[model samples]
Target: MSVNGDSEQQDWPRPSSSWIDKVLFLGTGTSGQVPAIHCVTKPDFGDCAACKDATLNPTGKNRRGCTAAAVVGRSAGDKQESTILIDCGKTFYSNAVVHFPRNGIRELRAVLLTHAHADAILGLDDLRAWTMGGVIQRHVPIYLTQECMTVVEGMFPYLVDRSKSTGGGDVPTLQWNIIDKDKPFTIPASQGRKEVHIQPLPVLHGYFGRSSPFWCLGFRIDSFSYISDCHEIPADTLQLIRGSQAIVMDALKMDRHLSHFSFAQALSFFASFSPPPALGLLTDFTHRIEHYATQEQVDTWRDGMLAAQLAGKAKLSRSVGEGGGTKWWSDIWDERDNEHQMTIRLREKYDPIDDHNISQTASHYIPPIKLSWDGLVVPFDPRRSPSMP
Candidate 1:
């Protein structure tokens, strides 16, 4: 659990010329998505409040698309800011139709894939809109691992080899580039734009068989990292992203999931970093999680950690296990004791008082670790420490 090192030494190598400025979350839901058709159409079914809200309000927080985002920034020598997309999941078209115009994103500099899952790569054909029957944009450069590219090749033979396309339908034009998990590569610069440095972080999505792990690629663009689908992060990856300024991670639900990080697991990993990341965003949610409700839980957890840091000691627990076995758990601010690991739970209520109303100052506030919603635009400055936007 211990990934702490000298904070100064853990800083990612800064981009020589270009850097990412912000990330736009296009989708935050799991593969099935929210307001699932089955749940809404079930006879006399009213069990899920989140899905109900999503159905009633199309653009509400409860409504979500498959997890994906765009890294937006201005590379040196570019006439305008460029947007590099992270994933093109099943809901890519749905998300793009909304967020692209909403954010004024006109150019797609590149597309980076995490894995070859249906939710992650099924939207490959949707790029036709961008290509526009050979009218607007030209061929887009796509980067992915050999395994992911192999899946794309089989699923989209026409895209890889346009000769296979039949019926004279206009297909998306693409130039494929194979990426390696161990190598740090550069996003090929568009006209007048400089190349952007990227470090690939291969994580365990699940397992292929009994032992071999299903690898997914996560990317680190300077101090920001995005891992939208992962069950476990290896020691090397952990060390590589130890002092990230901001991270958009996968937390599928409150309970443990076989292929995604549960709320507890994601928080534990965040706590492992010294002083934690400046901003920690949890995404890839299921209908089981209500947006505001989950944010409240994260707020409570943050308050508890802040309290422990202020007290300078682990607080005593009220409950005792069988045979008078008392349980103690707390999260320290700077770093946890490497010899022991603590399991922290969210409190029903962290503080009754309204801290915002009582005082405008946030001297004791811990960095936010909260859930992300669809169409959420998180702006950050790579030249400085991240702050709320």
Candidate 2:
């Protein structure tokens, strides 16, 4: 399936001056999230031993569900801003509120759907809260592939058949845009801001009912690529994701699964990949894989990757992103590495970005980076890519 955007292009043009500064991971857990109910219902006699500790550590990663993120853009002096939501799955509304400020939903410009699965599209209706308010409300735009539209219409007949009776209560106010595979599409940063292009790469998801294969998508926006929920990555899709500076793909567990990539399989795919992404991450983890264990695994991998780059065994691509930063190139031996180390600097004289004032609705970036107990947000840019910190 294809849309109004280019299906095949050598490259999606990067904004010469600036672009979105960061992509924040909203929730990184698999469909059931961590603390799976079955863990208790069916105890270790046959229950989840790995997730056993998730009960004691309520705020731990194993307690998570639904994976998504916010792609944020801002202007100098905070004159303009844009927030694009990737997917609003079943847990989206709950997770978004925790990650973003009160106005998070109200400020979204678009919603991109990777597929029609319940975990990926369930929270869609909750968007009505954003559309029903304000003196002048506007319909939110939703982007999806033709294959997705078919399943979506079947699932939410009310959303497709506008003619249906509503009995006066508000429903999702949306406008749908069909994206063409291998095609790149553009969305304005804001009303007068520059445009950001999103590249849609088609991937083959495993069969739905044992006899019929289905399709899903992964997207490349600017310097990063996000691939979720695919059992297989086709040759064409790999070609499309080749040049991303950072990539976050699905690796649902440590062991092989019918519908998702195990951690080893995921790492192997990119380890041998050409023009490998500078920083590679695995997401969409299920409770079966303990959060602490996965975090330790990722940390170990990062250490090894940095060691390889330092020893000249691997090449780390350089890139940079926005706000309170610069654009430059350097080698590992360069002393400038110290200068590029992320340091928080307040733009204001006295209004500090303390925990007290760190609102999700902040007009500009809070600082270079922010860490949390549940997840982490690492800033990225195309101009500078440093070793993992």
Evaluate model 2: give its lDDT: 0.59
Candidate 1 per-residue lDDT, tens place, 131-181, comes to 866554787789999999889999999989989999876789887999899
Off by over 4 Å in 1: 1-18, 43-45, 208-210, 315-366, 382-389
Estimate, for each residue in 1-389, the C-alpha lDDT of model 2 and write its tens digit: 00112222112222211345656677777778767777766645255654676676665545675878777765444565667777888888887766666223347778888888888888888888777754224777889989888988888777777666377756778889998876788775556655657888677678978576777777777666777777888766776776566677787766566777666556545544554454566678777666554555444443343333333443333442111111111232121222143111111122122333322332221111101123345454436432211
The TM-score, computed over Cα atoms with residue i paired to residue i, of candidate 1 is 0.82
Deviation in angstroms for 153 in model 2? Answer: 1.5
RMSD of each: 8.8, 13.8
Off by over 4 Å in 2: 1-18, 42-50, 74-79, 102-106, 135-137, 188-190, 210-212, 298-375, 382-389
Clashing residue pairs in candidate 1, if any? none
Q: What is the lDDT of residue 370 in candidate 2?
A: 8
The whole-model lDDT of each prediction reads 0.72, 0.59
Q: How many backbone collisions does model 2 have?
A: 14
